[model samples]
Target: MSTIEEIQAELRALTEQEDEINESLDALLQERGVLEDQLASLHKLMPNLGLIHNDAKQLTGMISFTSQLADNVSGKVRQLDLAKSRVLAASLRVEDVLDLKFCTEGVQTALHEESYEKAAALIHRFLSMDEAVLQLSEDAAEGSSLKQSFTTLHEAAAKLRSLTHSKFDSAVNSGDVASVERFFKIFPLLGIKEEGLTKFAKWQSAQTSTQIEV
Candidate 1:
């Protein structure tokens, strides 16, 4: 029912609308292409990001391991220092004992000479030396030698003690005043104070009675 002109005008308007739609579609496709390019770029960086994450994890583990290793090393060093100190102390103790060997010989000589006081003094020194050696036994390599020496010294001391007792009794029975006085002084040194006093009092009473009779 429309005229020819109206139909031509409608056809022209429809063609322009089609052109606008096609332009809008073209813009949308361009935007999609840009987004796709950005997504591809991000995908390309994924391996790098994964490598960075792995590196961070490895670094963290390395730090933890290094800290543990440091602690272990520090502990070992402290132990070594303590051990070194112990070794030094032990060496000094051994040296001190070795230095006192002459005192052990002196004790033997004094015992041989019936010098109980000197022997007792030397024995006291030896006891102190033995205590020090015992304390250092954990660190000493030659502890057996020290123990053997101490045993021999102890035996000698026992023998000297027996000999002294016999000599003192002999002197008392013989009524030798000079010998009795000399040995009486040795009794306290030998730690036989009560026994020595009892015997000495009996000998003194006997001497007093004989002097009164004379």
Candidate 2:
């Protein structure tokens, strides 16, 4: 499978296709659910019809029961077929979504390790960077207090801003883990009591593990 960046790029290019596929699958699922409901309704009706047919003394009662059964059975079969088609389409869409989701996981991992090269592949993905960018826009960024979430990445980003306006870009562009590690060490708030930093460190570890090409 493609990396997260690659998959995201592909998804952008094939948005229409994905939408069509999803719609096809969704319609089928909804139809199937309706059919299941109808089937249950028919089951309930059948028992009632059985009681009436056995108790009725008139010929009209037998004819009415047979006609009702015929209508219900025929309608149920048609509904069941429609429902089956919807379920099949939904299964296919699930596969497509999973494939794309796997790719997303890869890109997220790269960002955790500060792999700017991998992260920068999809310009669209940067749309998600706004919060991080705006929050760090203040050149006087100090490390976030332990009270905030993502304290480690935030602190690292701030120290990065202090070092250079483009420190993260430069270090990540160089593609050296040692430099990345050094950058992390110098990031603000490492000396603070924030557990967010400790938690962000786990993402970094996971990224490093995935970075092994083999």
Candidate 3:
């Protein structure tokens, strides 16, 4: 071949290599454009992500506070319940003490008025009262006053028994029907039904014998 023909062939080969390099550059430029779009989208989302992180921190703090508040409220409720129970117990104790005082005074008044049934009823109520409760009141508050009232009531009961027996005997000897009936009914109230019945029967027998002799 001639020298001019060889040079033209070399120039054609160089032109083909330049076309391949331009295709590669175009592909790289498209890839760079996609990366720039992704970066812009990430930048837009960053502020929203920061806000979500702050909201999550606030919600966690609120949950912790709520739990602490519930615990405190529960403790306060228990304390209130315990205090209420104590107040109720103290009120009951005071009521018992008042009842004791009233009974002591009532018994004395009934005896003085010769209201045997009323006195007996008061004594029965006194007997029914819990001794332990009375003792507890004395130990806690009333002390000697409660003890003295108890002693007075005991003596008063014995005296009332003796007085009733004497009155019943006097009524039988005098043949006072109303008085005998009154005293007989009182004996059952005083918890001496059997003794009252025996004595009444003996009196009836003696009266029958006297009538037979007459």
Each candidate structure's TM-score, on Cα atoms with residue i matched to residue i, is: 0.47, 0.21, 0.52
Model 1 compared with the native: what TM-score? 0.47
- Relative to the true structure, how large is the alpha-carbon lDDT of every model? 0.77, 0.54, 0.84
Highest-lDDT candidate: 3
Candidate 2 lDDT by residue in tens digits, 9-105: 8888799788999999999999999999999999989988988787775677778999999999999999999999989756654443343334345
| Candidate 3 lDDT | 0.84
Better of 2 and 3 by lDDT: 3
What is the per-residue lDDT of model 3 for residues 1-214, given as tens digits with 9 covering 90 to 100?
3798898998888898999899999999999999999999999999999999999999999999999999999999999999999899778777777877887999999999988879977777666677686686566356888897788778777887788789989999999978987887777766677988987888889889999999
Q: For model 2, how big is the CA root-mean-square deviation?
A: 38.7
Question: Cα deviation of 165 in candidate 1 (Å)?
Answer: 1.0
lDDT accuracy of residue 98 in candidate 3:
80
How many clashes does the backbone of model 1 have? 0
Prediction RMSDs, each to the true structure:
12.9, 38.7, 11.6
